[model samples]
Target: MSASLQKQNIVSNFRQISSNKLILAVSCYLVLILNYPFLAKTFSAIVNSADYNVLFLISVPVLFICVFNIIQSMIAIGGFLKPVLIAMVVISSIIAYATLNYGTVFDFAMVQNVVESDSAEAFSYVNLTAIVFILMFGVVPALFIALAKIKKQSILTACINRSKVIGLCIIIVGLIGFSYFANYASVGRNNRDLVHYITPFKLFDASYKYATRHFFSPPREFLELDSTPFLKSSNGNPRVTVVLLGETARAQNFSLNGYEKDTNRFTKDLEIVSFLNISSCGTATAVSVPCMFSRLSKSEYDKQIANSQQNALDVAHLAGVDVLWIDNNNGSCKGVCNRISHIEISPDSQSKYCDGEYCLDEILLTELDKKLKNITHKDTLIVMHMMGSHGPTYYRRYPTNKRIFEPDCPRSDIQNCTNEELVNSYDNTISYTDFVVSQVISRLLQLDESTGSQSTMLYVSDHGESLGEKGVYLHGLPYAFAPAEQTHVPLLFWQDPENSSFSLDCLQNQAQLIASHDNFFDTLLGVLSVQSKLYQKHNDLIAKCKGDSRIAFKQGYGIQTNEETK
Candidate 1:
């Protein structure tokens, strides 16, 4: 044969091979692009660390790929594989980028954060870099798949192919299970966060769990409380108390709590008691806010029970204390303010401070005098929910003019910023919170002078934030594995000169005492002088603050105590 004829034959053979294996090639490429970063990280950790054996290093990837292929094959059965695969690719890309950027794990709690976030909060994460990266790696492949002409197979052939894939996956998983069960257990015990890095599967698993827990779950029944005690003048003046619920404000950043930074410049000089050791019930608003107002202790608390039971606000309202809840934060009061006179400062409301997205914490104090004047009751309990230091957009929480810390991180995606910049930005938010709290106290003091009313204010954060400490950021980790940054929150107490219910000297002395959100309900009840049957005197921080409370699950499972603060 001639050399030219032989070359032509070889070229034809190569073209035939490519045509025959086009779908398989595309699938393999899709899997590689989608899972490359995750696989690289997993393998790199296994290689660098002596903890994992060679077998695990090999089997983990193999099993993961097998399972992935099985999922793809199954999804392919209904001719919907392209769309599903595209969605998975995009989702996985976003998750992978986030994991890499923030050094976070995609667990149930993280999924819950995503689920609970509003559209604006969600959109803040959409950065140019992440979008470009996704477009290059994820969207391009998805576009290719979308544009490709997939060959329609017979129903029987498709079923057979799916069955074969499933059978292969089962066999591979079974082999892994039988051969390395002990190794798997040991690795899982040591490296639980590793499972969260398994690309598309982790995203799917988290979504399923969130949907099951949030959407498919049965509605919790509301628990009603008995009639509350009617408030009468204990002294010569009417009782007016303001409870300031702060968000994402950690104790570690407060100068009053011995932090080096001047974050609490406004409140540091005020006659306020700052608790040095204070833990939150949960690391998220959905849990902590509701739990803080519940009668049950953290250990005894049940989400169902807590949600159903009448909260501290309910008791105060029934007790004839004019209860009003003013919120600058977007989060709900978790039904704690349901029956009371509640008003949210709409982001859309005309205000010099508001930008139609989020108003400053100071906006909650907008109509302070008017709100106070309209209340016809002698004793009033006002709850002000401030949008204090909520992140990963710490800069947005405070006004630009309030940026005391220089060179603050202006971006919402905190991970992209340097640690120092992130802290500076976060500290500015805390400083602004200090300013807001001081303004609130000043308002109360002014009210006291004008109306001869005795006033007091209590400021406590819903949860603390993690500013890139130990590879964690923006809080909301499960309480068991969360660091102090996510759990240790700030608690401040202030009262007017005329108010003498609790001695400041004694309260200041008690500031060093350990406390948690479990004390909030009873303490506030005591402050309002509401003698309710549900109020536990032992849990009241002001009445008798002595016991070490355990931070437990809402399901009554004891986890740890204030000792974990160390």
Candidate 2:
């Protein structure tokens, strides 16, 4: 073979490669054109992160599209490359939706393992995430690729029968995916049109030039607090109130609520009120806890935090509560400093005992014991926030050895775990929290008995937890959409029995009657002896149920109450 012969072979190979590249590029444009509805909404969110982790996780959807595209290509060879291009678009859309909404990067392999080992019931809800994946990454894209096949290729114009058939198949399937996307992206009645945005090409621009736009940035404002009279106790000394904030302690699981679980041994008689129909402001602690403490209702917590920004602690202090906060949470968000006294339980170097991954609420009790000594005056309010049933890593929230209710029948993962196991873990946390809170109540009672001073205890959780209802786990969903699990938390009050003012009958009635988290602001005002200037008289649980409040559930949606809306 001479030099010319070798050069000719190389030139032929280059032409073949170039032709394939052109075919693939053209296919991508076709899919994008066919599926414009889903792409537009998700684009900004996908590109915002401009991250490597996001791109890598996107492979799942990519593979889903690839499988569908290959099938279409095999059946209709005319536009074989179209399937691949469409797959790319769907994958990018996933990254766009998940990223835009501030979804965490999931460890798919670990999650899969958890689901596999656990009994089917154990991880039932967790598998919903998997379903979420298949839909976003699989079903919809495949539909497009399949439907794209509808447009028949011109047999007369085509030379290679195989290539032409594949190309046409690609078009038909791609169109199918688009039709589904149209209904899905629209957020309609049944489908609810959960749409995702972002195309592969846009994601590929890691330099983030596509994300760049000439937009105005909003100026951040400092949070403003309201002045009130919620500081002084019934006795009206210096006024110190300790609000123990529990996480995910649902009333259903408590023995106090008549559940078989002996979890609430601590709250046996001291007077507990079940805020029967009360709902959470949000699901995630990051969202709900801060939102609950915010002056805004669940309907407007996010909006209020976004624009106006006033927190419970901030207002309590301004009202002269001598607001002192000690948190056992993972971190701070509401910025409960500036105005009140702040003590971070997780970070305090002086904290001798608890360590690693959110403390088992007991630590707050111990810290409060030490801190209360300094509150020699009457009006000192202490807020203790606990890390309750935060999901996926429930075991991490509490010590494994302390897990009393085994075989736990413990499933390996979120999807695998049974409702019972999930509830058990949740109950165990509640049990531990009850023990700690009861200790505070008992001690306060003892202090009152010993010193001839008045003392009382109030306990409320930020929000409730979902076991596996409607294929959802944990909490922190948007308030309008959140389930009963996210909204209904436990509220109980324990007072010194010696005090005639601690009416047990009224307390029991309030527990069985209708109430809202909104009452937290006002009822505390009544208990603490200071009349809240901001208090609304309607929903105040103590005030409404003074004799026997019959209203069982606040019937409305998105935080609008009969009391407030009118």
Badly placed stretches (over 4 Å) of model 2 are 1-187, 196-217, 220-239, 303-309, 347-353, 409-412, 418-420, 500-502, 544-566
In model 1, residue pairs whose N, Cα or C atoms come closer than 3 Å (at least 3 residues apart or on different chains), thus clashing, are: 223-308
What is the Cα-based lDDT of residue 402 in candidate 1? 93
What lDDT would candidate 2 get against the real structure? 0.54
Give one digit per residue, the lDDT tens place, for model 2 in 1-566.
Answer: 99999999777655443223333433453334423433333333334433424443343244334433444344334455556545654564454333332231112211222222323223333435555654765557666554442323465544355455456656654664564444323323332222222233323342233123112334457655544444433444333466877776776777776779788787776555555556665555545555555566756655324335555555556666666677666545345443566777653334444554345666776778787666655566777777655455565556665576654434324546666776676666767777777788877776666666556577787777666776556654445455676677778765554443434555666667766666666676555555555666665667643322222222211223345567
Clash count list over all predictions? 1, 63
Q: What is the C-alpha RMSD of each candidate to the true structure, in Å?
A: 7.9, 13.0
State every prediction's TM-score relative to the real structure.
0.87, 0.63
- Model 1: how far residue 461 lies from native, Å: 0.8
Model-by-model lDDT, in order?
A: 0.76, 0.54
RMSD of 2: 13.0
